[model samples]
Target: MRHVISLLIENESGALSRVSGLFSARGYNIESLTVAPTEDLSMSRMTIVTTGSDDIIEQITKQLNKLVEVVKVVDISEAAHIERELMLVKVRATGKDREEIKRTADIFRAHIIDVTDASYVVELTGNQGKLDAFIGAIDPALILETVRSGVCGIGRGDRVLKV
Candidate 1:
């Protein structure tokens, strides 16, 4: 099964490296990884996506929690949360293709952030599936170059996961 591991860690240098090394040492694969400074710049959060058996997932969480630099670790895959990712998609579209591109973007609610004679840069933020569908719809007429921000999530309702 695929799992999402959300980690809150000290914003000090080498901290991310240590956490990443743990996965590397165990030969686990990271499908997606994103790190950003939290509201408190003294800390940062990382969301890592990996696939493994339940037992292996449990072990990964336990070991990650034990790391000194990790202030909090949560297996958000099992939590009730609102997860989002941001993507910037640059699509190569010329005059004839521009209309089609705009229509496609409207369907996805993606906004055109930049445009040139040769391309349109669209910014999209949503769950993974929405992004995938948006890209699929425009791919035929436009060549794509993409940059994606890994998952950022928040818990649901009155419950909160605090560091």
Candidate 2:
């Protein structure tokens, strides 16, 4: 099953490498990873998306705790959580196709952040499905490029990953 693991780690060089190395050493696959400095300058928050059975996830969590830089680890996917991903798509937009693209973007509540005579860069933020649907709505031939920020997730309500 897919698991979203959140971690609080020391905001120091090599911290990320070590964490990723652990997963690589174990031959596990990481679907997505997002890390950034937290409110506390000394620490960072890392969100990793991976798929494994319950036992495998539990084992991975335990191994993560052994890392010197890791202060906290939580499988936020175990309960109610909120997840979002950002996607920027550059599409050919001209003639009749331009209006159709605009309509599609509006329907998806996405913004046209950049535009030129022949192309538009649409910025969108939402869960994976929503972003995927937007891409699916557009003609593949018109898609010039696409970039996505991997899943960033946090537990809902009282659940929190912090020092």
Clashing pairs for model 2 are none
- Stretches off by above 4 angstroms in model 2 are none
Per model, how many backbone clashes are there?
0, 0
| Cα error, candidate 1, residue 25 (Å) | 0.8
Best by lDDT: 2
Question: Candidate 1 on 14-53: residue-level lDDT in tens?
Answer: 9888988999999887888889898899999899988999
Error of 2 at 127 (Å): 0.6
> On residues 1-163, what C-alpha lDDT tens digit does candidate 2 reach at each position?
9999999999999999999999999987799999999989999999999999888999999999999999999999999999999999999999999999999999999999999999999999999999999999999999999999999999899997777
Q: Which residue pairs come into collision in candidate 1?
A: none
Candidate 2 has what TM-score? Answer: 0.98
lDDT of each: 0.86, 0.96
